[model samples]
Target: MLAPVTDETLMRRIEQFIHAEARLQDEHAYEAWEQLWTDDAIYWVPANGADIDPKSQMSIIYDNRSRIGIRVKQLLTGKRYTQEPKSNIRHFVTNIEVTGREGDDISVGCNVMVYESSLRGETIWAARTDYTLRDEAGAFRMARKKVALVNNDRPLYTLSFLI
Candidate 1:
């Protein structure tokens, strides 16, 4: 059987990766954020339950590597009007836990509170984010990032910007 992780150094590294991701996204550094993901990574946001199959159900945003790149490009080019004026955003990533590990993949669970301000007004969004990070040589890369927004079931304002 596989043993649980008890390495402080390794844990710190993972925490840094997650924190950096939050910072990059908040700063609108799309190019840098794109590099944090693996070539086959997935970014998914389910519409209903967190356990719902994205393929079988409606999803808010479900993107493969190609789509992820395209989305970033659109944002950078200002082609996505929802982000035309851009929203001032800050991310609070907390309650991070190393939930599991198997082979070279590590599962992490985190709670995020994103505060956004735009001409529309101020909004606070909360979600449970689960990430599967794959050890890439000495670094960790995101293999899958699934975000279950607390208020996803209702009519949400334009979430054209990155979460």
Candidate 2:
């Protein structure tokens, strides 16, 4: 059993994790980004609404660990038309809060605004992301991430990069 950690320490660690994940994506380090997840990880972006079940509804991205690897492979292949030239993206996570905890699992929610620039032009995506991170021997690994895009219900442009 581990001793209770200070709120400041815990928040700092979580902020580091979130910032690192964003950096990995912005730098196009797909392999390193994938390594941030556990084996049973789930990366989901719900369509229509955030609270809907992925299985019974459509999802923008509902990838398992294997599929995540595949997605990265496809992106890195340079065959993805939308990402041929790649997009200059910088997403910042704000208003992050440690919402709850259950044993070794911690739930976090934050607002994210992603600015992307590509051949097609620039686009802004705003969303509220809920993350469930599992404590693995003091290090944290992302177990699940649910992204609720503000414009999910409307048809949007292609997104080759992870949110």
Candidate 3:
């Protein structure tokens, strides 16, 4: 049997994982990022607000595992018009909190600000991201991720880059 993990160790591990994930996105490592998710993953970005039901309300993105794979595949093709020039992006993940844990699954929340720069201009997008991560063979895999963009309630520009 393995030794139990302490809260301090677990928090550090979570922070490291989140930081690495952010780096993958910033570097546009789509394949590596896709491999970090579980088979039953849900990637959601709510449109109206944080509390709206995705099934009943509009969403910026609500992709299941297969759809996630497809999105990554498209990005990898170098044919995605929006990403043709490839925006310079950086993700800042902060205020990470362990919200809950059930069996092998842990729920975490954090505030993220993504800085994106393209030929057109620069934009900073802020959001509170809630994630459900599952421990798979001693490694963490994302099961669900919900991003509540601070400007979701108002008119916005294209979200061509990943948040």
Candidate 2: regions farther than 4 A off: 1-6
Hey, what RMSD does candidate 3 come out at?
Answer: 3.9
TM-scores vs. true structure, each candidate: 0.95, 0.94, 0.94
lDDT by residue (76-159, candidate 3, tens digit) is: 888877777999999999999888889999999999999999877898999999999999998999999999999999987777
lDDT digits (tens) for residues 23-105 of candidate 2 = 99998899899888989999999889878899989999999989998999998898999887889999989988888899999
Model 1 sits at a Cα RMSD from the real structure of: 1.9
Q: What's the candidate order when arranged by decreasing TM-score?
A: 1, 2, 3
lDDT tens per residue, model 1, 76-122: 99877767688899999998888888899999989999999988899
Worst 10 residues of 3 by lDDT: 1-10
Better of 1 and 3 by TM-score: 1
* Model 1 ranges with Cα > 4 A deviation: 1-4
